[model samples]
Target chain A: MKITNTLLQMVKTVSITAITVLSFSAHAADDKVYRLKLAETWGPNTPILGDATKNMAKIANEMSNGRLQIRVDSANKHKAPLGIFDMVKSGQYDLGHSSSYYWKGKVPNTLYFSSMPFGMVTTEQYAWFYHGGGMELMQEVYAPHNLLSFPGGNSDIQMGGWFKKEINSIEDLQGLKMRIPGFAGEVLARVGAKPTNIAPGELYTSLERGTIDALEWVGPAFDLRMGFQKIAPYYYTAWHEPGSETQFLVNKRTWEKLPKDLQVILETSFRVAAFDMYTQALDANATSWSKMKAEYPDIKVRDFPPAVLAEMRKATDELLQEQASKDPQAQKIIESQAEYLKKSRAWTAISTKAYLDTQ
Target chain B: MKITNTLLQMVKTVSITAITVLSFSAHAADDKVYRLKLAETWGPNTPILGDATKNMAKIANEMSNGRLQIRVDSANKHKAPLGIFDMVKSGQYDLGHSSSYYWKGKVPNTLYFSSMPFGMVTTEQYAWFYHGGGMELMQEVYAPHNLLSFPGGNSDIQMGGWFKKEINSIEDLQGLKMRIPGFAGEVLARVGAKPTNIAPGELYTSLERGTIDALEWVGPAFDLRMGFQKIAPYYYTAWHEPGSETQFLVNKRTWEKLPKDLQVILETSFRVAAFDMYTQALDANATSWSKMKAEYPDIKVRDFPPAVLAEMRKATDELLQEQASKDPQAQKIIESQAEYLKKSRAWTAISTKAYLDTQ
Candidate 1:
């Protein structure tokens, strides 16, 4: 009866003059189109992050032959850059693109999905996500919210951020005010520094007017546009977020409604887009960093002093342990990440690290 | 008239009992399925390399909803592990899976597509391929062969090779007998090493019986199975092939025959599969390296001395400059890759290297 009804519906809709095509596929319902609406944290025309959604939607549409049409609403349209998780969970939007760490207040475990302070690099973390039980842990965290999540894209290795003053020691961070966010901010607070969040629009003015002493925007790619290089003399290397990965959230019900092929297409498109964004970020960083060197020779590149970094690492571990003691799920995720990082880092030390160091 | 004829043909094919269902659409030709035959250069059930082809085929099949079928033929069936280029080029097979450098004898430019001595790592090379001018240059090379090429998968950073003795200096490499194939062999030859290509089947016995003093197979993932760790106590780090990427070849004629959707599906599948293979190699290496460490406590991991690496680097540049002088195309690719490597590596040094070093 369902098949009969679907056939009738298809005949009425496809074309009354083209009934010959209907008999060939008795399961016309399987060919039904699925349209999804996505809300992204980034504004339209945003570089790598925004490009990921557009790239994903285009590929999904072309591969599904227009069966899967994803209507993307950037933050301008959605007006909820930080509320993506809530919107996706509440079914206000069928999908979302945002960094997982944005939901740390609502779901503490969400912080692990994005790059952790001193966590694995991009490829190593990718191995962990796909092969090291990261996806399972991610699902466990999101399942209660009635959402499904995937790696949306990577922003490449995020720089430690720009600093107006050189951090010479642990003393240098004492009562230091910097614009950092989420868990890394907590780590900073624990180490006697004041970490604050500022709106993107006001960051430059805030830093310049002595409202903040330092800031860690994204790496060279995104930071170049903010004119941070002109004000901040020290461009520190990465530590807090080694390989930050953004995520795609799907309303569980919306995902269930998709046919098997369309589901595969949508998921594959997301995976490809995520990898492409990482590659794109790598290129953009390289290009922008080169331009920065040539254009601004005085922008001193610095790594945080060993004493400062060691203190920060200690604080990070302490914070992680505190959370682990309080939450079993957090404990499990942390332990899994720690063990995987040990083994994966060992292998990396031999392959990638060795290659890089020798070169 | 074409629509009328297609409708009449569909009516004649139908049982005539469902005449009402016969007019949905006259373009049944759109439903025609496409089957592609892929020849891989690995025997049945070979590990990571073989899995890439199968993985690609499965994803392409699932996404295409049976509209596209890919039949993968292993080297055991095709009886030509090295003939993939010829078979794919001549249209005997629609596609093929192999390494690009394997065809250096036939096409000198093919060597640059694979890893080079002291070149960019996997992610950097990937950035070069997708964002930089790699794809265009690669297309220029393969177009003449009537084929399209893509990054098939990465085998990770290959170890310099297993050796019976540690290489302390350039003097230690004089007259060293090693089983290192392709352009790395040329580099070895310049360094006064007798680089010989030994059949995979004879490698173990040759190394054990003193026929070969050393050999560089793949890394720990593929190398563990060959029992090299048991025989060669001195395991060296990679230099010859920093990031060995395999190639996926599509016959030009076969590619043209694909529908736009299938073409997109196939291409996306290729990208995902290639990335997946790299992750798989990373995980496999970590796993295998862990196992090897446990079982072979005598195994010693060594990096070539700074002096030795300097000589090899010099040899690599000289050989590259020699190739550039001979072919303008080679010079273009070499220069592009060199330029990309410098910028990308600078970013990597600041980002990935900084992260790794601090850890």
Candidate 2:
């Protein structure tokens, strides 16, 4: 009886020990959470641009069951909206949301990732990013900087902007003062137009007071609230920044430290957030444009005259050629984009264009 | 001394029991796995369509870290390519990948979720699905049968078809023998073409042997290997199923049973898979089209004459109206689509259309 009692107690003790081991591992696995900090270029409560990060964070946290938590700090907190690239690279921020072209000053090759003067539209550019070797090229550019980059979101097709005067011919564009920026400004300068950059806060005042002859803002979704329609008489269609895609920047160390599942969750969240933002922008643009037209009946939507567009196109081509000559990498990216664009545009013309025209 | 030893033994026993209980809950939390079965309409080893299911399943699995596992069964295994709705609704499968229109015979309201004849293109339709009350409408239509529907991958813009001869006018469509299925076939029949459905296995032989004079197939990505270009001299642009969206059908019970984290993981996978498929389809179409043009230099690309297109459009409208008059739900959906299309298309015209035209 004594041996039997001892044997039962021993069995009970062993079972309890096994349960403790299993419980400890499970608890560690379930309760351990990785908290990350994200820096974004957009200010707090910025509409489409800011929404991408919030949506991404929400989805990521939900998908990871609170294991992957991200804290987003907007421009107000960071005080360096344009420093996302450096911050993410140096691991000061785990991730960043910004447009790639902003880094072009430091890295000239970063220019091609965002929309060019006349580049692929959103869908075509997305295809290029995923299937047309654009992502590989993007990695080639960012990897050396200790960062990994993903296509963040698209702002849709940006309008050429509002012009106070109707441009009828190539001569009409001569010495025209416009608030344009970046490489597009260079293209316009070559075409005998005075391209200038004004701060966003001053764009409306500049256009209204004739401090600038015209200013190009984002399309109707963004432009409507700016009240540009009440001032500028002509809203020209887009030519520059046709499909401006933003970027999600991650520090290489941050990404490497994540669990494989968290990595997938993070990436998929980014993808959906990007797509949702594009759709949101589309709906917003459609709704806002309709509202603008209804409220402001005199808003004139015009395409730049063909002669002026031709000159701008010529200048764009010359600028691209000059840039290509300067860097082998630039030459490669330009050639790839041109080839992909030609092929995709042909299909686009026949499919989307055909359907629209027939309707 | 004897009382002290008894007290120590009691304490050891209680501590061991407490540790065991804690371990049990932790193990339960960390080790519990939820496995789901998915049914797809496509056959085993099918091309792009099958790949979508695989991609979705893979992402879901990776994101869940094996906690949520999904097994995919293609048509070959399920033996019910057209019975996805029944299977998923009965909970025979937790999820399904199929086009919503396939269930139209059983539920007419389901047809509107897929692409409509002469309707919005991919991006426009996607905008409608997400922002234009399409998801709610889809849920209304599907919720009755214990199912939830999502905008699955798009087939991009399907070509009108390869033709044995050019369709120059309405007269040319009279008595034309073609193999086209679904609502588009009805539109063609109303316009005087004899539309017939052929088994997929026999499609190539039927087209080759003149059993069908012309046939509507998917775009170049899908049609390239069928060698249709070798046989058909005329390739016409699209007028039907402008952007054919597939669907992901989920059993309500299955969805409800999932943890919140797993639910988000599944939905996000569906979203990314859908987006990835579109990009892939675009890339494949562009590549295949370039190849087809290179190899089949003699193939002529044409659009049905304006008069003929107008007739087909009228037929589509009439058919839709007839369906709407028969059912209140149909009317509501049709009106929603029409209103959204009008608003969205106006923006599309000024933005995407104008840009394409100028280029």
lDDT of 2 by residue, A1-359 (tens): 11233333443455445445443333234334678999999999999999999999999988877778899999999999999999998889999999999998999999999998878999999999999999999999899999999999999999998999998997877888999988998998998889999989998888888888988889999999999988888989989988999989999998988878889999998899999999989989998888988999898889988888899999999989998999999999999999999999989988888878888
Instruction: Give per-residue CA lDDT, model 1, range B304-344, as digits (tens).
Output: 99989999999999999999999999999999999999999
The candidate that wins on TM-score is: 1
Error of 2 at A146 (Å): 0.9
The 0-to-1 C-alpha lDDT of every candidate, in the order given, reads 0.89, 0.87
Deviating ranges (above 4 Å) for candidate 2: A1-30, B1-30
Task: Mark the 10 consecutive residues where model 1 chain A has the least summed lDDT.
Answer: A1-10
Best by DockQ: 1
lDDT of 2 by residue, B1-359 (tens): 11233333443454446544443332234334678999999999887788889999999988987777789999999999999999999999999999999999999999998899888888888888898899899999999999999988988999999998988889988999999988999999999999999997888899899999999889999999989888888999989989989999999999998877888889989989998989999999998999988998898988888899999999999999999999999999999999988888889888989898899
Model 1: per-residue Cα lDDT at residue A68: 81
Which CAPRI level is candidate 2?
acceptable
Q: Count the backbone clashes (under 3 Å) in each candidate.
A: 9, 0
